[model samples]
Target: MEWLARVMGARRAIEVGTFTGYSALCLARGLGPQGRLLCLDINEDWTHVARTYWRKAGVADRIALRLGPAATTLATLPQEPGFDLGFIDADKENGRLYYEEVLARLRPGGVLILDNVLWGGKVVERRQHPGDTSLQAICELNDFAAADERVQPAFLPLGDGLLLLRKR
Candidate 1:
């Protein structure tokens, strides 16, 4: 992610599922000086831990965290001079919605990475069942992204899976 940011020369970014902020730190550090990152996550406890590390890493001021539903928080962000990248790894059910919102706000040629897309390989299981909600959600989101015309999409065989989309 840091490499991607550097390659794109990205100065503004947002992360939908901050978790422990490891990804955020990587993104923030890559932004370097005169850049800003917004982190959206619902868990206060985990974010607290992230804040501590961000301070130690000296990137705390570069990142602003919001604690709430990612969609709700993303709506609060402005559209102009939009984000260069978006990393999604939050609630599986709302992954598609988050992708749509982020895509709309991302600048041209920007990227959006949806993580855990393979769902431990359940996405391609022979007897895939609807009972596996996360798997179903990932399948649906993957289909939507592939079929969408606004962005060029590619799937990477990484940990679980990664769906990379670059907005046209």
Candidate 2:
């Protein structure tokens, strides 16, 4: 994750799910001194843990954590396209909506990273619980991204699966 951000020279980043802030720390390490990271999550306990680590990592100043529904926070952001990179790992049912919002905010050369697209390989299975809305949403998002020409999309078989979308 840090490598991708560094290689892309990302100065601004947004992360939708910050469970303990591990990924946020990784992404923050790539930011320039003046860069910023906006982290959104609904779990206060989890973000508390993240705050501790962010301070320990000396990146607390660069990170701004918003505790609430990610969609609500994203909606409040200016629509004039501001981010250079974004990562979405929140509720699967709203994955496409999150993607649309993030993509619209991303600069022309920015990137959006979507996690759990493979759902631990269950995505290719014949049977799945209707309650597994995240998996269904991820599958739909993958298909949608692949068909969309505004971005170059690819699914990487990493932990679970990661969908990389780079805006054209």
Candidate 3:
């Protein structure tokens, strides 16, 4: 993720799920000196630890952590394209919603990465359970990205699958 941001020369980024700040740290390090990162997550306890790590890494000044439902936080931002990079690793049930919201805010040529698209291989199961909304949502997201013309997508089979979508 850090490599992607650095390669893209991202100056503005947003992360939908920041668990203990590991990914955020990588992203902040990749961003330019004047770059800014907005982190949205609900757990204060975990984010507290993330803050400590960010401070230790000397990137705390560039990151703003928002504690709340990610959807609400995202909705508060302007709808126009602004963000240069985005990472989504939050609730699976709302995968499509987050994708739409984030993609709408991503500038052309920006990258939006969605993690855990494979759901531990459940996505490829022979017979999917009807009640697994997370799996259903992920499958829907994969199909949507494949057919969506707004972006070019590369679905990597890396750990649990990472879908990298570059906006056109």
Candidate 4:
């Protein structure tokens, strides 16, 4: 994430699922002093952990935590045309919607990172449990992203497959 943030020269970033704020902090470190990060998550307990770490990392001032449905929070923000970077690691069923929202707000050269896209190899299975909506959504999202000409997409096999989408 540090490398990703640096590569993009990210000034403002949005993280869809901030589990303990590790990734958020990682990205925050790469941001310039003036840069800010908006972290959206429904878990206040997890966000509490993130808050502690952010303060310890001395980046608390640069990070804001929004506790609610990520989609709703994202929709409420003023349409800026684009953000510097966006990381999606939330509910799989909302992958497409999240992608659309984030992409609509991504700068021309900004990046959108989607985690667990490989679904721990479950995506290759011909048969899957009906309850595995997250995996199913991921599969659909992967196909959609691959065919999207607006962004350059690459699926990397790193920690359960990370889909890197760069807005064109």
Give lDDT tens digits, candidate 1, residues 48-126.
9999999999999999999999989878777664898889989998888888888888999999889998888888881
Task: Write out the backbone clash pairs for model 2.
Answer: none
Q: Residue 2 CA error for candidate 2 (Å)?
A: 0.8
Residue 86, candidate 3: alpha-carbon lDDT:
97
Residue-level error in angstroms, candidate 3, position 91: 0.2
Residue lDDT tens for model 3, 46-127: 9999999999999999999999999998899999988999999999888888999999999999999999988899888815
Q: What's the TM-score of every candidate structure?
A: 0.95, 0.96, 0.96, 0.95
- 70 in model 4: Cα distance from truth in Å? 0.7
lDDT of 1 at 133: 75
Residue 79 displacement in candidate 1 (angstroms): 3.6
Model 1 TM-score on a 0 to 1 scale:
0.95
Return the TM-score for candidate 4, rounded to 2 decimals.
Answer: 0.95
Largest lDDT belongs to which candidate? 3
Q: Order of all candidates by lDDT, from best down to worst?
A: 3, 2, 4, 1
The digit string of per-residue lDDT tens for model 2 on 47-114 reads 99999999999988989999999989999999988999999988888888899999999999999999
CA deviation > 4 Å runs, candidate 3: none
lDDT tens readout by residue for model 4, 1-168: 878888778999999999899999998998767779999999999999999999999999999899999999989987776479999999989989899998898889899999998888998982665678777888889999999999999888998999999999
Better of 3 and 4 by TM-score: 3
